[model samples]
Target: MPNRWLCLLLLPACISAVTLDCKHIRIDKKDFDLSALGGPKTIHQQRWLPPSISNTTFTIDLCNPLKKLKGIDSKEQCPSGTRVCGIEERYNPIDGVKEVTEVRPIAGEFSTSHGRAMDPEVTRLKESSNADQEGLRIELRGGKFPETRQGDLQKAIIELHCDAELTGNEGFEDDEAAVDVAGYGSMSKRAKDDKDDEDEDEPELPDLDKGKSLQFVSYKNEKDDVGVLRLTWKTKYACENAEKAPAKEPGNKSSGWGFFTWFFVVSFLLIAAYIIFGSWLNYTRYGARGMDLIPHSDMIRDLPYIAKEWVGGVADRMKSGGSRGGYSAV
Candidate 1:
């Protein structure tokens, strides 16, 4: 009975852990519709990561006002007459709390074209009620969100979709084209919607093979103050049946000669052929005696004669020196 009483006491604290004043902190619901676009479809995949995301931005509107703005703070203790439109809280996939970022609100009303208007009395009540509340235009800007990996070495499949009309590419023909991800991964076309036969076997096409069986991990839809909706998801790629590319053979390394190499080889052969042709012409014109006209044979024949002359000269010098030595001593 005491344990039950303890649980009852903890429940209220858990509910009020994140104290967001919903009435004062109002976001135009029309600005953010998670279901505005079609369901999430697989758009991209990577060997071990999601689609490259550099930075993120969130535009918000606070009821009252601040002239100069920097960024959103974690505790959200903004100056007076400014309402807290939204709080930017970033959470890691694995680690719990990465940051409680600031909420920057623009200094204007929500555009009528962009979203519906709130009641004038309700707006007045929000400002009059909260002392530290001011209307603001907040843009939450932060560095790239940290990417965490799965426990095991698993590929990540990223699904993406956006409303073409909202993104201003309504007439774009290939907006729905499959994203061929660096050839390491591929996106498949969404399956044809069949309400009556959900269990029917799908045709085994090249793009729709077993490589696409991604296990669902989590899903989220992000929409800015504009009506544009971006749907994204992260899942584990079905890599069990992923086919491995064949290893390159040693013979394939030198499969073809390049232009310069081929040119040098052909030039060498042509020069050799030209030399042989000239030699044959000389031989036909002047018989075997023409071979003696070649400088190679002439140099070989003179080598022995030159050596003999050099030896004779050295012997003559030695004899002269011996004769002069005996005479000088006398």
Candidate 2:
């Protein structure tokens, strides 16, 4: 399970190396004048301008119609380049006068209404400023929403930077040291493989045979719920000082290395526990059962007597046992 998750995680880090598309992060904070008695830092929402779209304008006309009403012929849509086209009526053949009636055009056929993005899942990350420190930079990917023309502009559009923690448990293919931005762990669907079981009786458990596993994580102070900027990110200012840089320690190496260091610390504790626990079992079960006959080989071997009878002994008392807490022992 860990292996699959590791692969999934490593895939991104690997790609990041080939192409570092991380956007520039700016933590906008106001520095109080020395005269002002120690003011704390504050985060202000900033509206980011999208990159320009070459050979295109933000202003596009609404769809124009094919036919106009007799009385409404003088009226036109709000913006130019709007088009709305539909089929007009055709007259039916009649015997007497053979008169033809005009068909009217409807609006739905070809029309353009200002459309907004749907399902914009905005994610945020902590980024650094000119100085490398903890900050947030939102990352957006293509989803159900339409691909935004890089030049869409809006008034008072504020970015809500998220603070969810993410982690990567993956390894590198070429044994190169991976850059782990954060220690905190992080963040999709499937189709039916079995044709027979369209209607399942029991709930299908997630397939773990391939080593894929789900990561549990959480966040706080979510400003909004609906959508965030598409193809854009919101990075927060560094909580710590942007200047007065700290140095990275040389002792720590790779993520896997950290695991062994910590894992061994736990393993050694468990081993000591087993040794002490096994000694206690041996002394309790057959401390003096047959000392002379018992060989040292059987007493303290690598594999302790695993049988429940030896370890989980029977508790019994020599007769007259009903007398309030009689001499009963293990």
Candidate 3:
């Protein structure tokens, strides 16, 4: 049988194409009956980090006000001489304490949107809460980020998000609504072991300026949304200074052939062509493609009758469009 495969081989080049130049970001990072548009997807955020070259934002696991757990921290553990640190009359009061140990923040900045962070209402009631009768501990999870290198890096911001909508079917104005965090400054065991090997008299802190505490907040979106915040490492060069000129390399001319020379040559040719023959080129491209030279010996070798159809059909097709008829033999 004549092979059916020969007919299938030419099918792909005959199909029409669909263009995909459109783009979008879902509103509220939310899920709705967007099945009509592509998704009714759930987009819950679990933590926040800072952006590098641009604004950074992310989310933290929010504790629910109505839930509680017990036995995580006993009331007896609030030591008599423990130290404490907090804003003026702003944090929950630690009671029955003979002493309060002050907390030294590794880095901190107050956020208007992230108020009541160590929310006493949540911590006190969740008996299993990382919260103590003294204070609360918290959990962090669910990260999505592009991979990053672990190098001479001291502080890292691995993810970012914004316009957090955390109220869960509730509007933004509830007075009790707030978000909180609980985590310690962390490093690898290798890092800790390196520290253990060092001198006891002097402590090393990563230079704070390079890894500044970060906060980015915008209140402009909507009532149901928490104002967005981003995180970032401190930039060595301030934004205003990035536009200043690079310093001179100090020479009258470059040393050898470079891309600059190649670009100059190509650009010169294009301008010269536009002035000389661009209109002619635009009009004659099809005529040019149809005009190909076959050597006399090769032309003689083709089946003569099929060759006549090839040449005559292409010429007639060109002439129908009021263009040059392609070449043919007498």
Candidate 4:
């Protein structure tokens, strides 16, 4: 019972320690805040290889794990704590009949151990690599493919570039095309209607006021190298001047005056009022002159002398070095 309670108490702390903060990402000397693009973004692509057609779906979330959406199944989705995931389905004709040959996870963590250390591997792109390319590179590993020479752990690299106009929906229309080309057939009528209704209900610019959007640029599976997937993302958050906007609460209004500010302001006003009222009283009642009209006049007058004496005593102490423990010679 004691051990169970201890584990429960420590769970929250462990979770917090490993949580990745995508709002503040630093690479080399540059900083990026991608918190605006926190949700998952997905892309689908189809390639026509000689004997088979390959259809791949890639999903990434900068701030959280990819959730299992309505049409996606738990088995087809990546394991929990996965920030980036890719699944590939191959269709081939066997005995004059088209069939699904293979369905496998191409790029993403397969083990639950990823929750222990979930920080994404990020780095800056080399200047000499591409003159036109400038931004941070992120690497996600833990995929397994036995056919590759790069060992069991496959990897994916995503390059984030800065673009002011993209909203991460640039290539979403290609999903239908990919599905058609792969001969995977269309989605069910209910799903299609739901998606269309969602599109109609959504605002044209959902993230315009909050922050900029992320756009999918391209995806390339390195055939020669094998087990490597390269992707590019464009967003204003990846820019050098990107800054995380201050979050606003729904009903709360921002005010410059805080507790200490009000405290000091109130103190000054009260002191001023007291001084003015006291001075008037002294003048009308007793004809007090000069500094004597002030309240607490004696204490106020002695303040300068007190401060000067204090300074002098401190200086003397420093110069004399205080009495040592040794007694004077008799």
lDDT winner among the candidates? 4
Q: Tell me the deviation in Å of residue 42 in model 3.
A: 23
Candidate 2, residues 189-251: lDDT per residue as tens digits?
111222244552332322211111111122111243312222111222222232321222233
Q: Among these predicted structures, which one has the highest TM-score?
A: 4
TM-score of 1: 0.16
Name the better of 1 and 4 by lDDT: 4
lDDT of predicted model 2: 0.25
Misplaced by over 4 Å in model 3 are 1-224, 236-259, 271-330
| TM-score of candidate 2 on Cα atoms, chains taken together | 0.17
TM-scores for candidates 1 onward, in order? 0.16, 0.17, 0.16, 0.48
Model 3 over residues 1-330: C-alpha lDDT tens digits?
246675566544331111110021122232111011111111111211110011111221121111211452333121111111111111111121122122111111111221211211111112443222221112211111111232111111112111122111112112111112111123222334444554422223222122122222221222333222222211211111122212222232545679989899999998777644644563466333221222232445667977899999999787787644645557
* Runs in model 2 lying further than 4 Å from the true structure: 1-14, 17-139, 145-330
What are the candidates' C-alpha RMSDs?
A: 29.6, 27.0, 25.7, 21.1
**Could you tell which candidate, 2 or 3, scores higher by TM-score?**
2
Q: Where's the lowest-lDDT run of ten residues in candidate 1?
A: 233-242
Candidate-wise lDDT, in order = 0.31, 0.25, 0.24, 0.58
Candidate 1 per-residue C-alpha lDDT over 1-330 given as tens digits, one digit per residue, 9 for 90 to 100: 999999989966753432222223333321222121111122221121111211112212221222224463324433322221222333222222234343332122222322212212212112343334322112211111111122111111122222221321122223222222222212212222332455645332223112322222221223322211122221111111112212332223555789999999999999778767766766777663555534355666889999999999999888787575556653
